[model samples]
Target chain A: MKLTKLLATGAVALGLATGAWAQDKTKVGFVYVGPVGDGGWTYEHDKGRQAVEKEFGDKVETVFVESVPEGPDAERVMTQMALDGADLIFTTSFGYMDPTINVAKKFPDVKFEHATGYKTAPNVSVYSARFYEGRAVQGHIAGKMTESNIVGYIGSYPIPEVVRGINSAFIHARKANPDVQFKIVWAYTWFDPAKEADAAKVLIEQGADVILQHTDSTAPQAAAQDAGNVITFGQASDMSEYKPKPRVSSIIDNWAPYYIARTQAVMDGTWESTSTWDGIREGMVEIGEITDAVPADVKEEAVALMNSIANGEYHPFTGPLKKQDGSDWLAEGETADDGTLAGMNFYVEGLEGEIPQ
Target chain B: MDLSAINPVLLVASLMVAATPILLAGIGELVVEKSGVLNLGVEGMMITGAICGFAVTVETGSPALGFVAAAVGGALLSLLFAVLTQVALANQVASGLALTLFGLGLSALMGQGYVGIKPPSTPKLDIPVLSDLPVVGRILFGHDLVLYLGIALVAAVWATLKYTRAGLILRAVGENHDAAHALGYKVIRIRTLAILFGGACAGLGGAYISLVRVPQWTEGMTAGVGWIALALVVFASWKPWRVLLGAYLFGGVTVVQLNLQAAGVAIPVEYLAMSPYLVTILVLVILSADKSRAPASLGRSFHAAH
Candidate 1:
């Protein structure tokens, strides 16, 4: 009888210990659209996740599911994380907007943070970096550097974010060199290296000396290196391995600061559903070091353009812009409102093609 | 549309590079299906080869040795599938599917440290005057050694399967494994050898993508090429030369669509993007109606005891 009582006491203690442990730790789950090693967008988001871990230590537990396709499938992953007792989750992809919303309704108590989506709920927060500002800088450099007067762009899906980037880059390129022409190819995938490489090479064969890509992956950089005398800018990550040559400069998405702050709020019970769009000024989008492949004067001009955007002294979609069909958009000295930029679907004048709607 | 910007010579040359990977993998799968064993693990095996070849190339700085390592890696993985289906008598379909999953997971694990590191490039075979002979030169002579090897492999496969003794025996076993076994032809042994050849060829195909095409390692870099290769084998009706033709058609359309988009042609981008798949299927489907069918014993597990 005494031995049986002892065993019963041990079982209760073990059960209580697990319950207390679960209550004490805040679990954060991350859903990534690409592998952590994609070396671009997903890789940068994962770095932010790592920063959260470093800040909170054992008080916070982190879990991540990578390469989650953006469809009904993403709903299953988000729901699974909620069922597993996650306190907050970050869905990092533009394609996961609907899935994030659907799962948010089912798990009303779990907090959801999605990247690059506009929808929000009582428990859902949306955040995105203002990447167009970086594109303005890249365009200035691309315009000044292209000896062939032809610049190539590889786009990953014709989303508003991508459309805005093309407009911003084209505007600056035209501003710098009136004779510059833009050649655009939509790759439709965010991270297929072979497809991205093919797009870059095709553009090169058509006489484009300067290449720009909004897709995630360093394939274009490698293609540019092989083509010799061609230049490309790093996208989403530093891609420092190809520095000083094909990769002359870069637009880096730095989410660590925002990730850390959000986690801290959750821990302190101060979290609220909000929309955050931070750019270079707020340190969410950073401009990587400009390598010496570019002339010193051109790098300085690019840096000046970047500073103007950060200081709010300039907006990428500034005055005198027109729609592709020649309809007036922003009049002289007028800037685009956040709502218009958020749902951007039209190409600016001289962008050379339909948005592929 | 600025039609003048599109270069026909460059377009054909790139399509050859784009087609080599699929050609290599398709010809390999054809041999496997011909041996009365169906392995759906081509994707997994190709990805495994991609990493193995990439890692070896990065370490040794020699693309040739890297390709050899890729072949060995692919064959070793296929050996697992052979043992499960041949010795233990597992369901061939289930075993093949499992092998694919295992290969994908294993490759992802092996490729951990190899991402972002560019491998040494495979040198192009510049054949002097022939390489400079305008359109003919660019399309026919200006490709890496492996691209030529892929063509040579298709020729060798065609010659051997159509005229050689080993080819006759292999076909007889695929047609009637029981009869071949009754005649003391060692049916299981022949099937195993075919599976190994398929794996090695698939490995070489995968290395072509990592070492020459994209020339860098990324997870799932082979993407859907292996599946395309598998479909090409069936689409070509298990014929070697047609597989080559199908690969070029698909690759050619792929390159041309991108070129069209770059040239700012007025075609819908989505339709252009899918035209390669459509054109290949339409051509091969029409041709298959005349005199083509799958091997009878394909995907059937054989047992001497039964």
Candidate 2:
């Protein structure tokens, strides 16, 4: 009798709490692929989340679940967030592409934003920054700085996104220094510092004077610092802590403007499903300050290249290019279309290893 | 392929550094399992130690003092597990898993402010004349004090477990706790001490990662190494020297795969990335084929009754 009375009272309280929560204020949810404290990729995304809060104040409520694995578990978290009255949700990371779509189908009223992905529904919109643009600048710097003529790239996965970065960087690097050779090591993880460090050390030992990484972490930067003369560029975030020596420059991912815009869209009832690929011009992909370690000429060249890419004067994937097998890929004076670049799987000419299927 | 890029001496030296943490954790678990306690909270104890070590080192500017605090922190976290399993007689597996989740959360909470802050660098031990000997010197002599300590602990553990009377008692308690209890042994007390030692060792391994390896405090920075150390203990089949061998083998595979990639070997990157885990499991299966030698009363609880 006592248990029944208590249960009835608890149910009433829970109902009233959720009822009050649903009455007003838009709730935005974020799902991160790593811990916010990673000081790299997830950290930047969390900064964007905070930016939304700062923009909207009490008019909006933001909640986030960090370190969410990219699989069925992500779907469950999204589903729960949607059910809990989230008006808009952002699923960050490429691996969350499918899960975001799957949950968006179930919660059609709830708006969905998936990062670095290409799937969409009536409710799900896909967005990504052209990180390869930043890679082109990094390539130029790496090419000019390499005394050993060998540049190492640490890849997180063999996905199209990563392959594109490698190809873009390699092309620009080889252009700057014709004698430059590329050594690629795939760590197969987004954020394992030890493995990333080991990859950096191996590349350094192999006479690579410059290291490029698509993985998230400052381990490679630290490893380059330890290796004394090796140069590196920060990936996904401006890892400025190791500046003036190992980290000469970096690629910064700026997601605040887009995140704030999307939240405002949801608030104004103007949200719609769309695919947005913003880069330097859109201020989505930013180049961090090139430190004193980089020669003034190289820094100028990198900045000029970045400006040209930003102002539509040049494309990173311009033609007179060949596939890895030496087959003609892009004819002279031709440029890669968005379709090809989006689904890019094969490496450009001169890259040795096959992109693991 | 650019095979000339591979340097044999540097490769061997790095493999030792890579193997030290797991080796330390494995040796600690070896002792705990020997005393009939299967505490699966190695991951939790390790992360707790990582944060504690990192925070203390940042505060004191002494890596050695940080390691001491890390060991103590790890042991304290393990004490919760000890009380639950040894005193309260809760199920070991569930309790251990809970401890891991708790430790991970606690470490994340503690490490909030310490993120991106660099800890004091651990200095490598320079042995006067020996460290200068061309190739062999760097491989053997030029390492931080912890690397040598990890190997020394393995040796001491082997010697103690093989020859000491205390080893016999611990083995007796593990193999048949009821019989050992009848023969006037404190099974719970012995197991508690073993658990604490395991926690401390795992803590030291975690510290090695945060202070020396990655040398930073990021959440989940230990990143499943505790579980690898757990598998390594079993892969070694409860032997100390074999644990060292297994650790170096795993580390060697890891380093070699990266080198192979750097050297531009023709293998697929995916295969090379998975090689360390595949090799470790394969060797474990091959070595354990003859006989399965695990402690008989491994996960059983004990209580003294009137």
In order, candidate lDDTs are 0.90, 0.90
User: RMSDs, each prediction?
Assistant: 4.6, 2.6
Instruction: Residues B8-68, candidate 1: write the lDDT tens digits.
Output: 9999999999999999999999999998889988888888888899999999999999999
Clashes of each: 0, 0
How far in Å is the alpha carbon of A107 misplaced in model 1?
Answer: 1.5
Q: How does each model score on TM-score?
A: 0.95, 0.96
Residue-wise C-alpha lDDT for candidate 1, range A165-241, written one tens digit per residue: 99999999999999999999999888888889999999999999999999888889889998999998889998888
What TM-score against the true chain A does chain A of each candidate get?
0.94, 0.95
lDDT (10s digit) by residue, model 2, range A1-357: 686699999987885686478659899999998888887899899999999999999888888998898899999999988888899999999999999999998988999999989989999999999999999999999889899999999998788899999999999999999999999998988988888888999999989999999988888887888778999998889988878778898889999999999999999999999999999999999999999989899999999999999999999999999999999999887889989999999999988777888
* Model 1 deviation from the true structure expressed as Cα RMSD, one decimal place: 4.6
Best by TM-score: 2
Model 2: CA > 4 A from native: A1-23
| Displacement of the residue B98 alpha carbon in candidate 2, Å | 1.6
